[model samples]
Target chain A: MSESEYAIEVENLNIYYGNNHVIKSINLKIPQKTVFAIMGPSGCGKSTMLRSFNRLLDLNKNVRVNGSVHLFGRDIYTGDMDSVEVRREVGMVFQYPNPFPHLSIYNNIALGLKMNKLVKSDKELDERIEWALKKAGLWEEVKHRLNDYPSGLSGGQRQRLVIARVIAMKPKVIMMDEPTANIDPVGSKKIEDLIFELKKDYTIVLVTHNPAQAARVSDYVAFIYLGELVEAGETGKIFTAPESKLTEKYLTGKLV
Target chain B: MYQFDMRRIKEYSFLGVISLLSFFMIFPLFHIIFTVFVDGIGTLVSTGPVFITGTLDDGGIGPAILGTLILSFFASLIGIPIAFAVGVYAYEYPYSVIGKATTALLEITQEFPTILVGLFVTQILVLPMGTYSAIAGAFALAIILMPYVAVYTKEAMSQIPFSFREAAFSLGVTKVKTVFLIIAPIAKRGILTGLLISVAKVAGETAPLLFTAGGLYQTYPDSLTQPVGAIPLLIYTLVQSPSPADHAMAWGASLVLLLIFLAAFIPLRLSIKEVRM
Candidate 1:
């Protein structure tokens, strides 16, 4: 594969929170326009590693990063490159559905666009918001109530709204950290289908604790435990054959 | 059976002592409000509207009311911006050395005696200008007002969960934009409550105005540099006079001051009870 085929190239990545070594040395090559899954048990440093992709880990005072994460061949954590600019290119959806509650639905979608000057005029902004919402499978449900707050929406709808917020930026890579963990079963199913639809246009890096969900959605899978990658390969190959005892144990529900 | 009965007796005694102490604590406030209304209402009725509109000769407190308003407004204008900036900085970088020092200084200043502030302003402003002025009084009040607004702002921002901060930053917004536009707006109700409560506090202050405000009740404040009389300062001066009429005037002024305080405080108190100290 060509070097340009990778959406994100994390090299010798290590993260620390004060005295604790959270993410030990690791390297990952996530392909463009595919659903790449990182699965681990809870508190296994999976979430901490995802945050470093967009420099969100920089918000924590105790965290220290010691490697480079390249986005489309541009090293994001190095000199002359801006983290704000990096965030615009890499959008993330958290475990919880967090839309800006104080803003109206219309404004929630428009905030990043307006703040970053992504769109030109009022008409352009409205068009982009409508487009993003439609892409996220939320436009029909919320079209009539665009001026309302997100507090009135259901958990699944709010999560889709968050997805719309990220999509409005037209980012190259989208990171989802257990996006459906808090939603109802029906809501989770809808998001799973939406994720399948989204992978055609954007690279989706999903973090999940459930192996079955990873098998159902992701094209490639990596199992991490105790801050180390135990195994990584195509989703089909990893599920069928055993590469490492740790990977087999984790898949069999014996490693957690 | 005996243990249950003993527990019931202990509970009743705790309730009884708590209610008794609470009533004792609130008794003085009620007694003071009752006395002020009884003595002050007559002065207000007999004097009519002039009681609020006229000068000392006309037996009105218009100048003092105007003075108090000017002082509070300007003090807020001077203090709120500085205090708000300090508070947000303290909230944003709380673990840093400067941030910790700022929080400690704010707490210390809150407990510092108000009289010393008055004396400091008197030396720096009044003595240099060669007269007691409203500006000097407002400056002193602004110093006292800073700690209240800054501490409240810090508390309000800290009350927000860390998740919101992450959500805002993840949107690619700069830290400045995230702090001022996003985070601050979410904390607006608490910040506004702080502004109103501090204004109410400074409006009722008398000791800070002793040497700063020269006590002018004869006329309305024509300029910021001129001497002025506040309702609290007027009451303080009237109570010391040997005249019976002055004592009546003091009671009426006290009533006016109390009303001002309630007008600002009650609605805010109703809207946000948790802002209470």
Candidate 2:
């Protein structure tokens, strides 16, 4: 693949928590402006791989990363690359809705813009907040009460609020670690729709345990089991006619 | 069925005994408050509000009330920031050696006798300045209250989920910004309650002020370097005097002190209606 075609390229990536190797040496490439899904069982190191894209793993004291993860053709783990800047460029949404309770819905989105000094005027800030909220499909529901605290919102609204917060930063890539795991089915469908819509302008990396979700939202799918990649291909092909026996078993629900 | 009936009877008797014992333990506390209110209110009624501004000889505790307020205000000023800093550091670096040491030191300080703190303050500040100044008393009170503030702050800050910190970090927020804007506001109620309780605890402390504040000021204190009077000190000294008028003043002072404690405690309790964690 050409250099410009990939949003993220991992080379011989390995992660260790103290003496335990959690993510074995792996090589993968995620295309630009597409929904790339990493599907795996619990504790399969899929979340760790997603976190590595933004260097969030650096926060863990005992974890060590070996090899390189390049974002848009730049090695993010290099000595001169600031982790803060990398995080700003690559956003992440957690498995649970974690809108800051101390801030209101408007401020939750406004905070990132203000913190990064992205807006020059109040008008611009308001516009951007509205834009992000609309993109996350939360603007209509929250338009009347932007000043209300996040605790007042339902679980799904709070999750969408979190997504709005990330979108407000205008990051190059958005990573979701089971963003729909904590919401109801209706909320999950809304998020899936948002993910599909987001892929038009942003590269999205989704980590999920549900193979059906990956098949529904992702363009490309990768299956990881026991810290190793079993298959990587088109989402439909991986689900319908997987090339590997492990991927076939996992998709068929016989792999426990 | 007979055995079940016997167990039920035994359980009811045990509960009855426990309730009686609980009431017995709490009876003295209520009795003390009742006696204080009766005696103090009687004295205040007879003496009039002039008793507040009147000197000890004239049966007024105005100077002592002023002194107590000053001491607590200054002590909070000195103690709160240090305690907050220590608490934040301890919570953020919980497993670090410095964090462990700070926790251990604060635990030890909480157990240290207040009188010893007074003696230590006297030796350090009183001897050096060649006078028992109000600043010395404030310093001693601050020391005595520091552990409470630190422990409460640590509890509050730690109660904030670790994921919140990660969320802020992922947004490119600096650690200092995360602490001030996100963590601190969430923990505000906890910190404020701790501060008020610390102030109340130090306000009633008499032994520490005896050696450090010198416990006698004919007029309102004008400077931090001058000796100051506090309600606890006034009550301690006046109650021991032989004059019946002095005894009445002591009762009035005790009433004021109790009121101050209530003033601090009621607001603290109301501020935290719903516990976050």
Candidate 3:
């Protein structure tokens, strides 16, 4: 497949926070419908890089970007593309489960659909919500409590609710920034299982500091250190036979 | 043993001193409440429902109570929307020039003497309208009410974690929708409490209505454009009169005003334990 077939293509993406350079010259290509994990140590700019993909960095005035990020052959950094639309197409699940606390579980899923006017009637909204929840593997457990607030749910359940919320938007690309970092072991395993199931339809970009998670889940793994990309390739090859010294150190117990 | 005994004595005496001082600090408040309840309740009881519902001739501050309610309600209606917008603007762009200026202005206005606000409104609204209208009084009170609500709004909006903000934005809604639709609802409790507290504060203010609401006491207020009398302004007038009868009425009105303030303030303060006034 050609480069246009990729879900996201980044070229020489350089980012700065005021005067401090955060993401140095980096190039990446994320294939469609694949679990592309960007793994790095804490504070190594993986989160920042993930934020840049959907122009989330625009929310902060201090951050500046000087690179082209093309999402499926369209240059998202170009002057005319609406950033809000870009974000709608690219959904994000945070490290912490943040499903709008004020909203009920059903409204949490319906909020995006309502905002975007993606669903027409109440019945359609209900169907879409049920569909998204089922896809997130949380429908049966939460179907009875759809009217309840997210604060009543566990951390892992909240994360799944957030995922369902994002899924309700029907985003083409879904990004997870350490989605299971704050969850319990059981919850984390369920999320990993959900991730394995979700990659069939949407492009998944997983950010993790854990090499074990990357090895277990990701089809493609990119190793980043400080502000630069150390190496990126098939997860198996990178884990078993890393060409770069930094990649090997990161995969082994030495780097962290 | 002597030194150790001296240390214990020192700590005990220090506690006793602070406890005494604290009691003294709270004594004036208790004394005021006691005096008002003692002096006012008799008049309220003797006069029956007339003290609340009848005119000054009928031994009631009925018009002033009505006027206070009207002025406060109108002031909140006028102030809350503008205050909320300014607050959200300041919270969204704390570093921008207008946002910084808005925050500073809110602070300065909060510290401002309310009498000056009344005088300014009197010059612009009262003098021009050629009468002391309820609108003018409400406008004056709204000026006083703005900074309280605005400051509270900004603080409340800022208190929501950054992650929620990120999550809202990630949903691809416009910044306006994200702030107003999503974030504003979450901060609604804080904003509501602030508005009510401001209402209580403005309801009991004498200076702001001194000139703006031109002391109506004979009958119930029928027009927003006509001269109005609030409970505080009426109490101020009654306290200065030579009549002993007026003194009793003043105390009764003061007690009513105190009750109004406490009614709005106490429950709100208790509901949000983390927020400090």
Candidate 4:
């Protein structure tokens, strides 16, 4: 595929923590405005790959990355591209709901807007917050209590609030690192639906352990194993006719 | 069943012994507080409120009270900002050699004698300035408190889950904003409690002020350069005087100091409760 056709392009990527090799020789092309799901068992380097997209791994002291991650043709790892700007363009949601506990729900969304200077006026800020919350499908449940702390929300609501926080930034791509893993089944279902809804507007890189979830919500599926990308293809093809024996074994529940 | 009964007896006896030891350990603390309160209250009742507002020569602790407040305020003003900066730096680079060095330095400073701090300040500020000023005294107290505040700030910043910082950074906020706006606010209670405790600790210290402040000023200090009287210094000096009136004044000053501590500590503990909830 042409580079312009992809929202994110990775070429010969490697990541390390001190002497430990975490991700090895990864290359991926994630198309714009599509849901790309990365599935693997625990310790498979799926989340590491997602974090490297925005350079979130830069926060770790001993981390080392080789090669490049190109976001819309710009090499993000190059010295000229600021990590902060890269993060603004490529946002993330963690496995656990981690809203700012000290801030009210409205402030939690407004903080990014104010910090990024995304809005010119208070009315514009409020409008943007409302739009983001609505996009995350949390506006109706929390509309009356915008000033309440995030700790008051249910686990599902907190996750949605975190999603709203990310959406408020209006990034080109959104990374979910097992977004629903810590939530209840109902919350997980809502998140899946939200992910499906979000694919029309944003490119999504989802990391999940559940093969069924990856099959259900993703347009493209990539399976990773022991710090390597085993296979990646269209979701239907990968699920129905996997190219690798390990992928087939994992899908058939024989080698989970 | 017999083994179970024996286990129960052993546990209860152990609990009883722990309780007795705990009471023994705490006995002196309560006795000192009780004695101070009884003696100080008697002195206050006999001397009246004027004892609090009067000058040292007149058997009043007013100047001393005002002086302690001023000294603690200035010390906190000097110490807190430096402590926070060091704390944030240490927290942000916890694994760096500099961070480890700072941790080691803070531990040593915490254990270093406060009298040495006073002597050090006396050499730096007192001798050169030609007068034992409030500034020197406050500097002494600040050095004594800095390590405590820094340790507290670092621990408070550390207590915040790394995920919160990740969330802020992922939003594209600068590191400064993440630390000051997000992390500091979340760690507010712990930081404030540390500040209060440090203030209380410095307020009660007499040796440092004696060396730097040159205690026993007759009036409230008008400037940082003026010699100032502090409560602990007043109590220390009055208890050694030959006059019975001086002894009574010492009791009153001690009471006032105790009240000051209660005022800081009670609210601090309450705030801790609020934060936990």
DockQ score of each predicted structure, in the order shown: 0.46, 0.58, 0.51, 0.65
Per-residue alpha-carbon lDDT of candidate 2 for residues B1-277, written as tens digits (9 for 90 to 100): 4455888899999999999999999999999888889889978888898678876667678889989999999999999899889988888788789999999999999889999999999999999999988999999999988899999899988888877888898999888899999887888888778778778899989988989999764777788998999999999998899989889878988988888788779977786754232
The per-residue C-alpha lDDT of model 1 at residue B260 equals 82
Order the numbered candidates by lDDT, best leading: 3, 1, 4, 2
Candidate 2 has a TM-score of 0.95
Q: Candidates sorted by DockQ, descending order?
A: 4, 2, 3, 1
lDDT of candidate 4 over A5-79, digit per residue (tens): 899999999999899999999999999999999999999899888989999898997899998899998889987
Worst 10 residues of 3 chain A by lDDT: A1-10
Question: Per-residue lDDT for B214 in model 2?
Answer: 91
Candidate no. 1 TM-score = 0.95
Give the better candidate number (3 or 4) by TM-score. Answer: 4
Candidate 2, A36-58: lDDT as tens digits: 99999999999988888899887
| Best candidate (score: lDDT) | 3
Please provide TM-scores, in order, for all candidate models, with all chains considered together.
0.95, 0.95, 0.94, 0.96
| lDDT of each residue in B1-277, candidate 4, tens digit only | 4355888899999999999999999999999899889989988888788788887656578888888998999999999899989988888888999999999899899889889999999899999999888899999999999999999889988998999889999999988999999998998888888878777899899888888988754876788898898999988888899999788778878888999899879966785632221
Taken in order, the candidates have interface RMSDs of 5.1, 2.0, 4.5, 2.1
User: Which pairs, if any, clash in model 3?
Assistant: none
Specify the CAPRI tier of model 4: medium
Off by over 4 Å in 1: A1-3, B1-4, B267-277
- Range of the 10 consecutive residues with the lowest summed lDDT in candidate 1 chain B: B268-277
CAPRI-wise, candidate 3 is medium
